[model samples]
Target: MTDHVDVLIVGAGLSGIGAAYRLQTMCKGKTYTILESRSASGGTWDLFRYPGIRSDSDMYTLSYPFKPWTHGNAIADGEDIRRYIHETAHENKIDQHIRFGHRVTRASWSSEEALWTIEATNDERPVVITASFLFLCSGYYNYDAGFTPEFPGLEDFQGEVVHPQFWTDDVDYDDKEVVVIGSGATAITLIPSMADRTKHLTMLQRSPSYIISLPQDDPIASFLRKVLPLGLAHRLTRRKNAALAIGFYVFAQRFPRLASRLLIGAARKRLPDDLDPRHLTPDYNPWDQRLCIVPNSDLFRTIRHGKASIVTDHVAQFTKTGIDLESGDHLPADLVITATGLQVVAFGQIEMDVDGEKVDPHEKYVYKGMMFSGLPNFAWCVGYTNASWTLRADLTMQYVCRLINHMDANGYAFGMPDPTGAEGESAPLLNLQSGYIKRVAGMLPQQGSNSPWTIRQNWFLDSRDSRRADLDEAMVWTVRKPVAVAG
Candidate 1:
């Protein structure tokens, strides 16, 4: 027997939970179910269990707008974030609506019936579900495996090797000399946390990334939480953080040289006088790639105390004891961690089709950074690359709910993006030069050069447009013909 629902949400993670909450509360009488591929609800938080696995963005903005974060730590650990997700799911009674281990493999939309036939595998058993609307909240990155570049002589290395994405509890690294490859956020976070346990720690990278230090706890947020109501305090803090982040991003984009100097200066103040400034400096301009943040200058403190170090060099090969540098130097290590990055898996690798035609994401233009061109009754929750992810996520959920309500009032069976008014060149959905994004650029959707079609990574802009934009302005809303009841 095939299950039927009003709405089918594709993920049970942060975005999925938020989507469910909005659908249940605002869009009353709509029945929805979340299909989670994994056994757990916390998508990224549950998957990543590496040392020092914590959010780089502050929790104030990373958290849902509806749920005020009571935790004191702005930079929360993976476990805490996971717990928060679970708590939200439990409190909202969304857990009962979620079907775990149900990996959606294919979805076919029928215009005649105005419904989506979703096919999935639930514990190796076939499970078919039909829904009027499909909400994809599955995150952009692949959960099964992270991006690991094959290095020459890796097989010859006798020492233990690990990737941050697949880190397990059984692996031991106490008092071991650890060398972390890549200068991204993962490496930056792992360096400081693993330094205390390791005999010596080294962060080896081909090119440096911008590293900034932020306080783990926000004094203003802390005070606001104490003085005001939780909801009001959360709103105030969320606005403040959003404004600061937007201002910084704009400043960096406008004056790249000045922004780079200021960022480097900030790092220099925390580093030892003897430490080489080049290790913390990047060749690219600020915001060219996402910045790496370390709370309380933990990374700098570890480096300054001689407990950890940074090596700016390319790896020639993995030696038996450690990695051999292209600069004719060898770094000794007992464990080598490839904090390289993640693999991009678009839409959880689900095959989507409309009216018997397969949907090629690269060929379609993104509508409002949520809906896709020529696709009806489908929306995705893709967050910002420049700011906190949840900032855009919250807006996306609200916009989707608003859209659904508009459709219901207008008696529309489904709504799809009509690009008749959209003209001009198309760009990649994400404008980031990050390795993970670039690796899967060909498979991702494209965005147009105009409003409602272009994806602006700014949170304020997205929030305003999503809230105020007219659904009928760019969408081809349709209503199924009512079948006449026979006497």
Candidate 2:
């Protein structure tokens, strides 16, 4: 099947919906389509249904700025987030443009045609859609399944095992001994919430993660929400959080040792002294990997009250009885939750080729973390590594809208960040220490060491560059030129 649209958006998540909403509002006369792999909206929020799941950060920073989140808590739960995404889609009428059950398997660019050919499987039927532009809101995490550490005898265990991603309404852990594997944010988030409902909860981590504790609720933000209107409370929190976020980022970058001490102190307070440190403390910088967000950090309160316990031991294998640790210790459990991190996919593992020459994104320079050099009319959203991801996401959505308006007003089919010698050549995108950056290795391109896109992970720099930066500084935006009509 062949379909034509002005723009094709993939994913239907926060990024995809944000992109689609802007496109629909801006290109009112043009046709647009959104192809989501899942039948529902709310990409990650809908996908993750594990108990004790909620937003790691405050809702004020996590929510879309255009709309106010009226949820009672500063850090929202899955249902609220899912409802928020659904509500946003409804308010913007984005759901009407969305085509559910269409999974985009491949998106290839055509230089001759100056368009992207998106191949998707709709209800298992092959369909191809062509559009002047392709926007990826598919997110970085995989939806197929969450990763589970290889257990030697996982099948031997008679008890039911669970990965948070596949959590269902049927799996009941109430008043039963349960073990949650992994020390990351998911495990941290799960421990406190499940402990309340379970007879016993044990957090088993082969390795430890930096656990920063906060109260289960944000008292200040919560108080503001109770007193002020949701809109005013949101604005107040946004400004306060934005400033705090920027300040912390500056301190972390400028004074690494000092920042680490401050963060480590916080983590130490939450974790026990008897627990082994070798596996828990990360070898890298704090923000280099993600920092766990604990609202009121209910995890600490749960542990302190003796309702939950944390163990730092290398898991050996799964047995019929329970999980065996590297120390030859056995921990018995009726249910086990594998909350072990997530698999990161760069550009959702999509391949882009300009003409016959393959555009290896890993080898291409990233412009503004959205556009790739040598490729035109393509934009992707990669949010902040720290703080509420939506903070950067909101700004990015607005920026894309600006770019769309700039292109339409200027009369350009679509302009790409041409990193050729004509503009500014020899940019690289590799960081010496990033796991994702290292994974790409030789295939990854590097930006100038000083380029905002290179070292500018902070919200302030991004805010200035994306919002107020001179457009000329970045090699994005289109210079619209009339298309030559067919003879």
Where is model 2 poorest over a 10-residue stretch in terms of lDDT? 428-437
Q: Which tens-of-lDDT digit does each residue in 1-487 have in candidate 2?
A: 5788877888898778877776666557767898998999999998988876788777777787767766667778988888998999998888999999998887777656767898888778998999887878887767886677678999999888998888898998989889998777788888887888888899887555565655545567778888999889878877787777667766777887777778777766766666455644666676655667787758877886788887778778889889899988899989998887566566677666676676666556666666666677777776776667777666666666677666777776677775551234444343334343454455544564446446356676677767675544556444444669999
TM-score of each: 0.98, 0.88
Q: Pairing residues by index, what is the TM-score of model 1?
A: 0.98
Which candidate number would show the highest TM-score if scored against the true structure?
Answer: 1
The all-Cα superposition gives candidate 2 an RMSD in Å to the true structure of 3.5
Residue pairs clashing in model 1 are none
Report the lDDT of model 1 for residue 122: 88
TM-score of candidate 2 relative to the true fold: 0.88
Off by over 4 Å in 1: 419-422
C-alpha RMSD values across all candidates: 1.2, 3.5
